[model samples]
Target chain A: MSGPAVVFDKVSLELGGTRILDNVSFRIESGALHCIVGANGGGKTSLIRSLLGQMPHSGQIRLEGESLGPVGYVPQVLDFDRNVPMTVRDVMALLTQRKPAFLGSSREHRAGVDAALKRMGVLEKELRPFGGLSGGERQRVLFAQALEPAPSLLILDEPCANIDEPGARIVEDVVLELNAKGVTVVWINHDWDQVRKLAHSVTGINRKVMFHGVPSEVLTWAEPKAMVS
Target chain B: MNTIYESIRLTLQGLAANGTLPQAFTYQFVINALLCTLLIGPLLGALGTMIVVKRMAFFSQAVGNAALTGVAIGILLGESYTSPYISMFSFCILFGIALKYTQYRTNLSNDSLIGVFLSISLAFGASLLLYVSAKINTHVMESVLFGSILAVDYTDMNILLVVTLIASLVVLPLYNQMLLASLNPSLAHARGIRVRLLEYVFVVLVTIVTVACLKIIGAVLVEALLLIPAAAARNISRTLGGFVAGSVIIATLSCILGVLMPMQLGLPVPTGGAIVLVAALVFVVTTVMRTTLSRFRATGV
Candidate 1:
């Protein structure tokens, strides 16, 4: 039930003659809720992209696991056209199955898609056009898709970027619940309070590994006032 | 395949003799044209959904324009006018790949790239048409620019049939992945789908279908057949299944009526223009209906 420990060895990435990430190295303990904290344009997404093999970077990123398990990813932003005519259920089928979406989502065989939506509180919106959903609702749908099949390693980039507060809380709960179940959660979190309160460890990146430590040790520089209170 | 076409033609002839169908169906060319529409309709309709959703309308239209240059180049290269398969196939495929490759290599937007490609192809087709007009008859030029129902034969029916089958087999099963790839290449790549490879496969599919369709839809108006049906379907449908099914039905009907109406009314319209006009009519009707329904819903009427 446990997941793999990820290792980054001297990772460096340069895009269009500009260095994005330079010689960054760190290790994320398997089965821990590890949060990545960084400012805007700090290459957090790029690092995760490298881990998912989306970018060509000079690095030896290894997942140390007995059996390499499935990796689930929820992107930071999904630009869906307003009139493309796809339902949330249709999108789940699109993301999760190789079955043609034109065949429609089979309720009998796709209990999992419904279940994940229920977990994210978007089950009622399953039949609605994906584009019509509010910003927070769309984020919930993305989280639902990533959680199904109970991935061994989940990579979330700003999962709560534009969501409302209550919606953000629901997503945060899911991440914590998933981590407690022994899934490796590599989350790029913009909200510092959630990371400070819940993350087992934190890694700060500003084109490099600026800091990597437990939440207690990391918050001294991020917010000394929060640490005092 | 020819036996199948022959048998269908005979059956239609029997139906026409028995007064079950119009007398126009008695002609082998009418039967041939209808058969071509039968296959081309569903193929373009279904692929059009993907093309429309991917925002590849311009790219596909550019390919249709390229088909003109392909045809002219085929004629100048001494290829026959009836079925210039090789020159047309190679040129369109090459044009499609090069356009896709340049999109990846250059900083220019896809529309700008397609715009430039379309302009060059149109210019090439214009001059080539003039050059070949002296050698081939002006009548043949009309057929090439627009579609000619009379020129369709059993060979075209067979080629269209094969492409339709191949396209259906490839597209129907992997439709989800293809949709995802176009929507979000990074997500598709993360899900272990080869995005770049799928792009090429899609380009090739569009090329073959575009070339195969040149006989009936013609170069100028083929993109209309591809876009109109799918656009109409999207205007009303709210789910993927409905969208695809609606597009296929509208497209099939448009193709059938496009070919038959011109013949029955004794109009001298080209088959390509006829098809587009019919499809555009459907699009207009559906759009009005959708707007009215939405307004009614807004007022709780």
Candidate 2:
């Protein structure tokens, strides 16, 4: 439990004959706030997808020296066909994969959903259509959904995209709070300021691990151009 | 002549006259309609929801069109209309499975495969129908093309009811799994929800429901049953459960109106067309209501 929560050993990824991640290696320890920064198409998303096992990779990824539990993913946004009806809580319940005998949320599930939504500050809109949510609110609900089953590692990719300053700050604060509570955080962001503020360790990735280690050390070695412009 | 307008009036009157009693009576047609409703309502409702969600109406259309060959083959072999549904189900399933499985194999897109199957199936069905024209009843051909409530029999109703029940039973148990897979398959797979199995299961359920509804809605218009009600429901409902309830309500009303109208008023209109027309009307009305309500809420009125 005290060891690294996730380890990527020489992982390489190719999509459409294009090398996305080449010989990337890194380790994220439990309760560690790990920030990953890169320019556009820097294999940040690719690495995250590989961790989630969405893409085929040439190397191995271990979770806590063992296989990872379902890595709870908080997407940048949940832009479902706005016409497809669903509630914030319904999407959360989808994480559990349980069926209801009748219409609507079951009582027990409702209670759990209530707590999760309240924690994420979107409890009142639980019945609202998911597509109607504002960018920040949607991100919060996704956070609630990801945390509903208490995932071991929370992987967020560009969650601050298309949001106001206040919303971005709110997400950073929540992520920081969660990291403090022993959840390993793998945040892929283009905001270097946020990374310096939240990440215990930083990884500057561009198809490979350019720099890795303590935030201060990585910052010294990572050139200004290598970070987000 | 305002046949359409007059038809609508007569249909409403028929619904009023049928009363709760007939629907409560549980005779073959009524029972069958209810059974068909129970079976088809959810299956189509769920599939329709997915269609609306995934924007897969074209794919569903392709599958429905391809079913024509199965029906034609069944009739050529001296089978009843109901029996052809099985063949339709099998053929559509095979075609859909093939289309989906070959998705990652080649550069040929999924839509291209759908288009290919759709054109071929339509041509095959048309040719078979022409070949068997002498033996086939004109009314039967019309029913197959446009749909007919009058042609629904006990056997067809039983099949529809049973299939609906079984499909619902299976899907109800895996609701979360299916929803998860639909919304985000990769995430769902990582969660240990067998994504592949659920995808095939969903296609099979849709095929069965398409076959069940063929007699009532016919091949051409059945996708409407899977799209319109769900689409209309989505315009108003904010929750998944509310969306489903809205779809069922709209579909049941459309089916009943479609059937009872022509019967009570002696209209020559087809049941499937009536259903589609009613659903379209409902869609417009729902949109208006949603806009009005949201405006009212916004204005603090």
Best by lDDT: 1
Off by over 4 Å in 1: A107-109, A222-229, B124-142, B295-301
How high is the CA lDDT of each candidate model? Answer: 0.83, 0.70
List per-candidate RMSD values in Å. 3.0, 6.4
Error of 1 at B34 (Å): 1.0
Q: How does model 2 fare in lDDT? A: 0.70
lDDT tens digits by residue: candidate 1, A31-88: 9889998887888889998998878899789999887777878887777566787888
Candidate 2, which segments miss by more than 4 Å at Cα?
A: A1-4, A65-70, A100-102, A222-229, B1-35, B73-82, B104-113, B127-143, B186-190, B291-301
lDDT of 2 by residue, B10-115 (tens): 5544664678343322233543444455456556766677666655676767776766777777777777754566677777888777766765456465468668
Best-fitting candidate, scored by TM-score: 1
Interface RMSD of 1: 3.9
